[model samples]
Target: MVNPGEVPTASVSDLPSQDLVLLDVREPDEWAAGHAPEAVHIPLGELPARAAELAELPDDKPLYVVCRSGGRSARAAMWLNAAGIADAINVAGGMKSWHTEGRPLVGDREGVPPEVL
Candidate 1:
């Protein structure tokens, strides 16, 4: 289990523009609702088979993961770390918290898409 204090996380307020890679594991619909501008979409189900998609990230560059809340991306971060992508970090509370705080988000904003939220 992840120690509450030990999980490395980045608040939406503190996110930087470059260097770090923001990976969003939410499904396409959720992504359509909104996400971070710097974030890239790579749904969790595709991560294992699509590891090569992240070849662009440097070992020293931080990798931040987020989902609708905190669950999926947290697991994805752990998985990435186990696979030697140790820089992966789970952004606690995910997009919901970001939105709650009125943080910036990208993509569609019409409503929460039905496929994922």
Candidate 2:
């Protein structure tokens, strides 16, 4: 088990999606603005009550947490690790870097293509 507050991290550009589960901890509005199509949404504020929902995700796939930036996701990843999901990883720089790195995103928020909120 990882130490408290010692969640692992990964850069957006180097994220290996095939081996991980992308968990978006951003708020609904931010998520609606733009987010990775394959990511699973679970707002940080709701994590405490909704953590059980994560049990259904494949255990072999480590959870990679993300948000608009890296702050909230770090907290969420730490919480997840504490909750027994030992492999939860915080996606460094979050969606901002993902968008800046030209990663593919899926959302239809007017003329706003794919941008970090």
What Cα-based lDDT does every candidate model obtain?
A: 0.77, 0.84
Residue 31 error, candidate 1, Å? 0.8
**Number of the top lDDT candidate:** 2
**What TM-score goes with each of the models?**
0.78, 0.87
Query: What TM-score would candidate 2 get against the native?
Result: 0.87
Best by TM-score: 2
What is the clash count of model 1?
1
Candidate 2 regions with alpha-carbon error over 4 angstroms: 1-5, 17-19
For 4-104, candidate 2 gives per-residue lDDT tens digits of: 34768889877885655789999888888888988889899999898888888888778899998788888888888877854688999999999888887
Error of 1 at 57 (Å): 2.2
RMSD of each: 3.5, 2.4
